[model samples]
Target: MIARTKIKPVLYHVVAVLLGFVMIYPLLWMIMSSFKPSNEIFANAGTLLPKKFYPSNYTTGFRGFGGISFSTFFKNSFIISGLSTAGSVFSSACIAYGLSRLRFKGRKIWFVMMLLTMMLPFQIIMIPQYIIFNRAGWIGTILPLVVPAYFGGGFFIFLIMQFIYGIPKDLDEAAKIDGCSFYGIFGRVILPLIVPALITSAIFAFMWKWDDFLASLLYLNNPSNYTVSLALKMFSDPSTQSDWGAMFAMATLSILPILLIFIFCQKYLVEGISTEGLKG
Candidate 1:
């Protein structure tokens, strides 16, 4: 029995390690290939290690196209992601608080509508949204990308509502007794307690906004306003020889912010998801 138990754990760990490596292999391959020469990338497709570490790919990719540098793309991505995330988190928190804590007629109906919006895919509304933005002269500006985030995303609101629901109503009642208004109670009492959920939402919002390609492509027609995702797409040319090495180099660089955020805030993310209803 003891021998079988030990063997079972060893087998489980081996399988887990193998599966993890298999899942991450593509990312690893891409990182390794970035160090290779453009011509040699496909020539040694099966090999993970480059024959020589060519750092020139990073330089070439950073130079960017049409006189616009990769630094500009990076700055634009940061601006959009930062503003959108801030708007999403703050607005979602307020909306979640009202939905979860307040008593009002038609509350359930409004909540249902919000939940239904989550079920609708972006493609269904894309054309309508584009037409509206075009009419407002916002198609070529970041306004189309950043403005809507201030209205609160359905998913973020839902996540925060669940978190808020876990808090005892007594807290609100106590605040009321202490002469606090609704807004004062929300800012002073509820917001401080919901830090985990807010951080969780912010992390997700930032990562999604950072990696958003289709939205960036749709709204940003000017090369100067292009984001990292858009800039990466410009690396490929079907009619000519594409610089695979530089593309891979920039692609590898693009994921660092997300990786670092997850690594640092994963504890809060896990806690926010798992401990919501358990809190009194």
Candidate 2:
């Protein structure tokens, strides 16, 4: 029985490692190919190491197109992502707090509507949203992308609601006895306790906005206003030659911020998700 138990765990670990390698192979290949020359990238595709480590891909990619540096794309992504994340986190927290703690008429209806929205795919609302934004003259701007976050994202609100539900009711009662209003209790009692959930929300919000290609493509027509997604596209042209090496190099660089955020906030993310599921 002891031998079987040890062998089972060993087999499980080996299988897990193999799966991990398989999942990460594409990313590893891209990173390795970024160091190869454009012409050599395809030729040496099967190999993990480059024969000649060409550093020009980074420089060439950063040079960008039409007089705009790749830095502009990175900057725009940061601005859109930062504001959107802040708005989503704050609005979601506020809305979730109300939904979880405050008693009001038709609150259940609102909650149901919110969950229903989650089931509704973005494709269903894309055309109407485009027309609305076009009428508002925000089609060529980032406002349409960032402003909606302030309204509270359905998934984020739900996640935060679950987290809020996990908090003890005793804290709210104690705050009430101490003459705390709803806002006061929220700010003083609940806010500090829900840091993990907030960080999880922020991490997800930032990563999603950072990687968003469809919305960026729809709203941002000007090359100067393009985000990283658009800039990456510029590196390839089916009608002509493509800069695959530079594209891979920039793509590698683009993932660093997300990787760093995940590394630092992973602990909170896991705790928040697990606790929310268990307690809620």
Candidate 3:
């Protein structure tokens, strides 16, 4: 019986390792292809190792398509993602605090409306948003991508609300007794306690904004203002020869930032998600 138990755990771990490899095989294939010469990439698609390590893929890819360098794309992506993440985290926290603590007329209605927004698909509002931004003269600029983040997204607001609800009302009452105003209570009492959840929100916001290709494609008309996602897409053309090696190299580079962010914040991310569940 003990031998069977030991064998069962070993069998389970073996299965899990095999499943993990299967899931990650494509990513591994891409990384390997990034090191291969363009000609050998398709020929050796079934293998995970390149016959000859070609370092020039990174160099050629970084030079970028057209006259614009990838440095510009990286810079633009950083600016848009950083600003959007800041706006989303702060605004969501504020809106969530109000919904959780404040009592007013139509407050429940407003909360319900906020929840309803999450149910509405982005495709439904995409055209309307484009028309609104176009009329506002913001189409060619990063404003369309960055500005809406300050208004608080539904998922983020809900995530933060769940965290806020976990806090004790006595803390708010104590702050009130200490002569703290609404803003002061939020800033002093609740904000410090919700750090894990805030980090979770920031990580999510950064990843979403960084990987957003569709919005960047639609709003950004200038090649010089293209983001990493757009720049990578420019490497391929159906009618002509595509730089598969360079595209793969750039694609690998593009995921590094998000991977680093998740690695660093993974502890807080797990904490926030687990604790938030206790409230709702």
Candidate 4:
């Protein structure tokens, strides 16, 4: 039995290591290929280590396309993503607090409708949304992409609502006895305790907005207004050919913020959906 237990753990770890390699192989290839000379990319595709790295991929990506600069793309990405996250998190927290805590007529119906809205796919509404925004003169502006964050996005609302529901009602009752209003209880009491859920919501929102290509493409026509994802598309070409090396480098760069977000919030993302499922 002792021997079997030891052998099982060793086997498990070996399997885990193999799976890890499989998962990371693409990213490793992308990073290494970013260093290779454009000619050798296809020839030496099998190797984990590139034979020669044209470090200029990094340099060229920054100024590779005319004088456009990667910095401009980075700036647009950060601005849109940061504001959207802030707007989503704050608005979602506030709305979720009310939905999960407050007592009012027709609240059940409203909650059910919120869940129904989530079930609806964005594809179904895209045309109508585009038309509405276009008529409002928001087509070429960042407004369409950024403004919706204030209304509390569906997913974030649901996430924060789960966190709010997990919070014990006794705490709110106690706060009420201590002369706290519902708003105060939400702000000072409930908000402080659900930092994990808040961070989780914020991280998800940031990622959603940052990596978004469709909305950015649809809303912003000018190359100067492009987000990193839209800008990244500039790397692809038919004639002179897309520099896979620089493209991979920029791809890696694009995912960095998302990776950082998960690394930072993962410590608190420990709680699961069960915590959110409970109701008082």
TM-score against truth, every candidate: 0.97, 0.95, 0.97, 0.93
- Distance (Å) between predicted and true CA of 71, model 2? 0.9
The sequence of per-residue lDDT tens digits that candidate 2 reaches over residues 1-280 is 9999999999999999999999999999999999999899998778988998998999999999899999999999999999999999999999999999989999999999999989998889999999999999998899999999999989889988888888888888999999999899999989998888899889999999999998998899999899998799999999999999999999999999999999988999997776553242
Q: What is the lDDT of residue 80 in candidate 3?
A: 98
Poorest lDDT segment (10 consecutive residues) of candidate 3: 271-280
Model 1, poorest ten-residue lDDT window? 271-280
Which number leads on lDDT?
A: 1
Distance (Å) between predicted and true CA of 237, model 3?
0.9
Model 4 RMSD to the real structure? 2.1
Kindly report which residue stretches of model 3 are placed more than 4 angstroms away from their true locations once superposed: 276-280
Q: Could you report the Cα RMSD, in angstroms, for every candidate shown? A: 1.1, 1.8, 1.6, 2.1
Better of 3 and 4 by lDDT: 3
lDDT of each: 0.93, 0.92, 0.92, 0.84
Instruction: Rank the candidate models, highest lDDT first.
Output: 1, 3, 2, 4
The TM-score, computed over Cα atoms with residue i paired to residue i, of candidate 3 is: 0.97
